[model samples]
Target: MHFPVSGVDVFPLIPPAVAFAVSSVTACAGTSGAFLLLPFMVSVLGFTSPAVSPTNFIYNIVAIPGGLARYIREGRMAWPLTWVIILGTLPGVFAGAWIRICYLSDLKAFKLFVGLVLLYLGIRLLYESAGRYLKTREQTIALEKKFQERMRKIKSKTSTHLAAGIPAEAVVKNRLVSLRKIEYDFWGETFSFNTITIFILALVVGLVGGIYGIGGGTIIAPFCVSILGLPVYTVAGAALAGTFLTSIAGVVFYVVLAFTPLGMHNAFSPDWFLGVLFGFGGFWGTYCGACMQKFLPERLIRGVLGILVTILAASYVIQFLII
Candidate 1:
């Protein structure tokens, strides 16, 4: 079947499944598979249009919930962090939608903007992986090791189950004061970090995502884990929750922008049929990714995902400069 808006042929099971796989893997390190898929749509599928951005957002809308549900089931959702992220991200998405339609209609300029954003974010994540975050990950690992030993002792000693009243509460008792410091205690273990700095960082990440039609989790997740010294297990749900709300805002903003007077000659609107088609595949993929995420080691997960994202960033940079 031919998809009209982007002029790409839709194949059964193949396209959506490809989106699902990309999202499922990339999301492990807190990125929406949408970033990588955009290039695929343009270079491979020949679906290069402004509508592609919102269609990418549509993929997020479908793919994220499955993983989020898994996180909820595993008692890992961070409600407080989720709330802060959504509150900040929603308006920015709208502003970004406007900018894309009004000023960034030039694909070349937008490509450069997109390249620079990915380049900066990719380098930051790489730096964190190489050395800056090593000590923090070690400390977190030490604390987690201690916690696991305690859990093993309890499981062996007690027959109490969840119904027997084991409380697993996810609440933010302390406010993040600054980038150099944030502290949270969970399961009788205290974790501290520099949080104030990350808020500024998160904002910049959000803007890049806004411009490029992405969920901030892809960027925020690594910062939370490597730089802020938060556990990926807990942050995954929070980041997913944040991405969910922001995408909702992004879609609405794009739809509204489609009706307004913009620089473009064509009546710009998201191709709903195309978006939904991608979403159908992404939904199942996220479900599987989220479940597997719990079983995977944290270091392996981040290392693999970082390499993939860096490669994608490099591709975009090379394509932009070369073409």
Candidate 2:
């Protein structure tokens, strides 16, 4: 099928199939898989336009609600964290949309910058994952063992009536919220982060997301996990929620820009049909991923997140060098 706006031809089923596969895995780490999808659209489907960024946002807007709803239903939504991320990222995404059309539409240097940033984030995550494995081996092993025992019980014929995988203890409870700090409880442990720090990070991540069409979740999730000392279980929902809200703002901004003088030289509006197809696949994938997340150990999740980011970073760096 030919998508005139994107000027690409391929099987229509490919988009959703790829989206389903990508989102199912990435959603485990709080990403909507837009980062990976953008590359697929560019390198595989050959949709290289300013509009692609907004189209990426369209995917997030459509795809995120599935996992977001799952997170909420599981009581893992961190309202305070989500609010701060949205507040900080919304403005940055608007600014980024403008920058993408006006300055970065054809800039090779931008790719290097993004590649370096992602490389650093990827290394941070990998280092943190390794550190956790090396330093807390006993505790981590015990936790995983305990979790497996619980799962075994849940899987037994006698306990089949209980809710699957996600234990009631997985719920997130907001303990405190203030300008300087925010705290939450998950599975009997309390996690806290500085509000200003996260706000600033979200702002920067939003700017990049706006330019990249990733909704900032890809960048923010690892930061929350690796830097903020937050658990993957607790941060996943907030990160996805932040991405969803920002993507909505981003899509609207891009559409508005397409009609304005500033966007005259750029195709800022998304190809809605293509985005919808991808979203359709992503919806089910993310929902299933979220359902399975709690059943896996945090270290395994962190390792998966690290590997994905590292591979993406390598691809970007290689593309930069090739360019």
Candidate 3:
């Protein structure tokens, strides 16, 4: 199928199928996989335009609700963290969108920026996965192991005895929220972090995500898990929620800009049909990832994801410098 808006042509089924494959993996880390998908759209599909950013946002809008709902239904949503991230991210996304159109429209510069961001994130995650100072990574693995054992027990029961959904013991509970700090309890362990620190981090990540078309969750999730000493199970829901809302804001900004004089000069509006196709795949993928998260080892997930991201980052940088 040919999408005129972005001037891309490919098999109709390819977008969703690829999105499904990518989202299924990234969603386990509280991201919608837009970061990975953007690279695919650019390098593989040859969609390098300002509109691509908003198209990515549309995917987040359509795709995130599935996993977000799953997280909420399982009582894992961290309301305080979600709100803080949204508040910090909204403004940054707007700023980043403007910068994307005004300054980073050139394909080479944008790719380089993306390469650097991914490289930093890849290194950060790989460092965390090294298990040196990340008590939270270790804690998350232990907690998830316990949760999975419980899930096995629940599954082993007869249909009549099986629990309706995630057990209450596995749910996340907000213990406290303040300007300076926030605390949450997960499976009897209380995790605390500085609120201002997260807010600042989200703001920066939002800027970078907006430029790269990812909605900040890709960076936020790992930062929360690796640096802030938060459990992955508790952090995933909040990060996804924040990304969803921010993406909505980003799409609005890009759409509104597309209607202005700027639209004539730059492709700011999204290809809705193409985005929806990717969303369809991402919806089921994210849902599946959320459902399967507790069964996977955190160490394995982080190690694999870090390696993949690092390789992709290296490829982009090399392509930029050599090709």
Which one wins on TM-score? Answer: 3
- Measure candidate 3: CA RMSD: 3.1
Candidate that scores best on lDDT: 3
Deviation in angstroms for 265 in model 1? 2.2
- Which ten-residue region of model 1 has the weakest summed lDDT? 162-171
Q: Give me the runs in candidate 1 sitting further than 4 Å from their true place.
A: 143-183, 192-200
Model 3 over residues 54-114: C-alpha lDDT tens digits?
9999999899998989888888888899999999888889999899999999999888888
Can you write out model 2's per-residue Cα lDDT over 210-300, one digit (the tens) per residue? 8878878778888887667677777889899999999999999988888998677767779999999999999998998888788776767
Candidate 2 stretches greater than 4 Å from native:
132-149, 152-166
Taking all chains together, the TM-score of candidate 1 against the true structure is 0.82
Kindly list the per-residue Cα lDDT of model 1 for residues 187-290, writing each as its tens digit: 44455654445556556666667777886666677777766677776777788888877887788877777776662564357777877777777777677777
As a whole number from 0 to 100, the lDDT of residue 3 in candidate 1 is: 75
Better of 2 and 3 by lDDT: 3
Global lDDT of each model?
0.68, 0.81, 0.85
**Which residue segments of model 3 deviate by more than 4 Å?**
133-168
List the candidates ranked by TM-score, beginning with the highest. 3, 2, 1
